[model samples]
Target: MHASATRLPSAAAWTVGDITVRRIDEIALPPQTGPWLLPGATPEVVSQLPWLKPDFADETNVLRLASHSFALTVDGMRVLIDTGIGNAKTRANPAWHDLDTDYLTRLAAIGFTPESVDLVLLTHLHTDHVGWNTRAEGGSWVPTFPNARYLTTRTEWDFWSTTELDEPRTQMFRDSIHPIRDAGLLDVVDVSAEGTTVAPGLTLLPTPGHTPGQVAVRIDSRGATALVTGDCVHHPVQLADDALGSCVDIDPEQATATRRALLASLAGTDTLVLGSHFPAPTAGHVVTDGDAYRFLPYGM
Candidate 1:
């Protein structure tokens, strides 16, 4: 952990009917300038979205972005949505390189340990999303959740395993992903199906373009619904302006289209939207705001 790490409150949980979704934070970042993070998120543009103030943005209008994971508990199983950057891993970005945090400790506090996790789902095989899939053990990487089965789309697995990646990213695969497969615990599913059901009320919806096989988890129970957005819409600002795209998107045009379509489908509906990188109070509902859309965060 960083010496100046900020201590956030205990993980918060929200219920969609009988299922409970909990947030376990790895890091809550300080304000980051709009232009630096999202080119289209200029000061002038972000300033106009007054709804961003306080929670999503600060007084100066800098956007707040965090890296965390969600725990979905139902049907007598513990499902981890995405694993944030793990401890002692080699990363290209200095900020993410070789470090430590009490991610598992926090999970334990919320009544889960590595072994207790029944399933580990990765929206995509990005460095940040798959970091905790494995951990350093006696100078070798090993699956962190010994008993859990890690799930990834067949398309995603094929793409990453065969495509040439940079040294750092390749290292990410070596340390976090391959070990799980080596342990005979990784399962590649067909995401092209109408919906891939992980449990009774939980399903995976393909929302490619952030990565070729990226997916979003949809939960429906007792008529209550929620969508776990996996970088499809990184920030609430994207909801207000569909033209803006993430600087790191693999296919910007496809990503933008996916975001617009996803937002359009859920706008004005009651489906809860939980963003993978959204700041605190990350659960919300997407509502139509004029020709564009806006994120109506929970409790606001």
Candidate 2:
């Protein structure tokens, strides 16, 4: 375990009709390689920004968890929103491959089984987002949810599958994506052309920004709604300064507009908000904090 993970609280869960959403855990990559996804401004830029601060977590807390993934269960379907960095995979960053957290086991506590997953919804194809897309099997990568169909945005697939993808992100296309495609289980979603109804009460909202074809998932039942804001707005800081962009974002300006639009949609309703990368127990609602906004955690 990393030194920072020790301070994390246990995982938490929430339900929307037949859909049960769980905030898996928190994740942090070193600041040097890239800026954290939300408000992905460079450290120097972050330092200069008026809203930026040195620390976002409690100093006494040892775990510095930041990113997150969610598991979604609806009707008879068990689905995972995004897979966090998986264990025992070799990466350019030595620290990344060495991570060995017990996220799957944690899922078991809430009645989820790896085999039980019916679909895996990937907002986009990023290394961290698809780590658990497959697992090691017979010395080769195999689908993590063998019975599930791995969904990716169509535009994202068209981009990454082409030579246009840069080196750093290209391997992610190979390592996490190719295997599923080879296995005949990858589903490319047309977020622009059609709105897919994967199961009852679940909908895919095309909220692109952080990536070319990024998307958000919405769960509604009996007028109660929840928007699973995949990477629409990574951190609360983005709400404060629309110009600040996460380091890895392909287009910062578009990302800002997407964030603002999402915030506006979730502003005054009881609609629950969930993020793929927020603090642990990642399900929460955004409320105005000062001139900006703050993430209000749902009861753990």
Best-fitting candidate, scored by lDDT: 1
Query: lDDT (CA) for every model shown?
Result: 0.85, 0.67
The candidate scoring highest on TM-score is 1
Poorly placed runs, candidate 1 (over 4 Å): 1-9, 30-36
Please provide, for model 1 over 158-247, each residue's C-alpha lDDT reduced to its tens digit, 9 standing for 90 to 100. 998789898988899889998999999999999764778977888999888889899999988788888899989888999999879877
TM-score for all models, in order of appearance: 0.94, 0.82
TM-score, predicted candidate 2 vs. hidden true structure: 0.82
Off by over 4 Å in 2: 1-10, 26-56, 60-65, 193-195, 289-291
Global local distance difference test of model 2: 0.67
TM-score, cand. 1: 0.94
- Cα lDDT of model 2 by residue, 1-300, tens digit: 000111223456676654556777635655433343433444444444342232333322211235566776677788788887777677766546657777778767666678888888888777778888877778888887888888887887886767476665576666677888999999987775345666687778776668888888888766667777777766545555656667677777788788887787676556778766555545556667666565655541
Cα RMSD for candidate 2?
5.6
